[model samples]
Target: METSAYLNAVVEQTNTLAGWVHGRDATAPVPTCPKWTLADLVDHVGATQRMVAMLVGERMTEPDSAYARYVPAPGDPAQWRDWLTGTAAEAEQAFASVTDDTPVWDPSGAAAGVPFWSRRLFGEACVHRADAAAALGLPYELAPELAVAAIEDWLDTLTSRGYWENRPDFADAMRGSGQTLHFHATDASGEWLARREPDRVVLERTHTKADITVRGPAADLLLVLSRRRPLSATPTLELHGDRTLIDRWIEHMDWVTGD
Candidate 1:
């Protein structure tokens, strides 16, 4: 997808999420994220969006110190929502002004340019939008292409340097099997196959099934793979081959790549 489209989707999803947060039914629990209430989920997502916007827009070298200055303290829900909406608007404007090829640091050493943040922010906002919706017992929807790309990004990010270093257990489990895991999106014809090797986890787009198969709508599959929503939560998912392998894969999956 084009960078403009992705950025636009981020803005749209953020706006939708804000509305959900302000709804009367906002007290509901987010089943996807067990420990957080709808309000807490909104605050968390808002804080994350603001932090990422700062990291990419200002080109900060150390994120913790810089991000801490802008983040809302715990229990400050109103302030947090205000910051989220304001920062999301700022991020939208900043991204809208740039071209896809504009130079940007690849904090993860994976890819460079504005497109990376465009895509990352898009997926981040989209998935959390689903989280907010699921929390409010509302329907979740995403652009087909965006959903597919989110899944791809999730897989790629999990195997990247940041995830491996932080989640050693996950990395070990991922490396335990020489077997591969395949994700097939039935609606959009999107596919991803990942193989574990000694040196690195290799991934590619292919139709062939691996040792396990995760088949469902692109959006549901994306949520399931992201661990934002459980597979059993959705009726449409079809798990072929070993269920335990799929569980292991999900247990080890990482959402974000960089520290």
Candidate 2:
């Protein structure tokens, strides 16, 4: 998808989530996030969006206190909503002005640039939108291309600098096997293969059957791979060679990079 389209999707989803928060009972708990109320969910996502916007806009190399300057206090419904909508607008505008290839530091160590933030923000907003929707028993939907790209970005981050420090166990598990796990999106013609190596997990776009084959809609597959949704939700997934390998892969995988 074009950079603007990705930004549009992020903005649309963020607005949808903001609308949900505005309409929801402030005291209600979020089902997917368990410990959070609707207000808290809004706060978390809004805070993250603000953080990313600062990181990219300021070319930040370290965490900044500016991102936390507007954090909402508990039970502050009006402030929470304001933060969500306000920060989302700031992020949307920051993302809209950049070209895909403009360089920036992504702690995830994926491809650096406006495209990285574009894809990351879109995926983050969309997934949290799903979280909010699930909390309200509403249906969730995502663009197929956006879903596929999100999965790719996440996997790249997980196997690179991002995962190494936070999830050593997972990183160790993925090493030296030379084995591969393939994800095929039945609806979008999207395919990804992750190959295990002594040094790092090497990911690429491919279609050949590997040790396991996860099959689903692009969005569903992305959610499952991201651990936002359970694997049982995707019965369409075909386990080719070793189901245990796939199970272990998911169990040990860590998505966030950089401690």
The lDDT per prediction is 0.72, 0.72
Name every residue pair that clashes in candidate 2: 162-257, 162-258, 176-197
Q: What is the TM-score of each candidate against the true structure?
A: 0.85, 0.85
C-alpha lDDT of candidate 1 relative to the true structure: 0.72
lDDT (C-alpha) at residue 15 in model 2: 79
Model 1 ranges off by over 4 Å: 23-28, 73-83, 97-107, 111-113, 254-259
Enumerate residue pairs that collide in model 1.
none
Distance from true location, Cα of 90 in model 2, Å:
0.5
Provide the lDDT at 99 for model 2. Answer: 58
Tens-digit lDDT string for candidate 1 (1-259)? 7777776777778877776665334456777677667666766666666666666676555567555767652454444445556767777777766666655565555555577677777778887888877767788888777799888767777777766776767777777547887888888869988888775677888978678888889998988888877778877888888788888888765443111
Q: Could you give candidate 2's per-residue lDDT for residues 95-133 as a string of tens digits?
A: 765556656666565546677677778777877787788
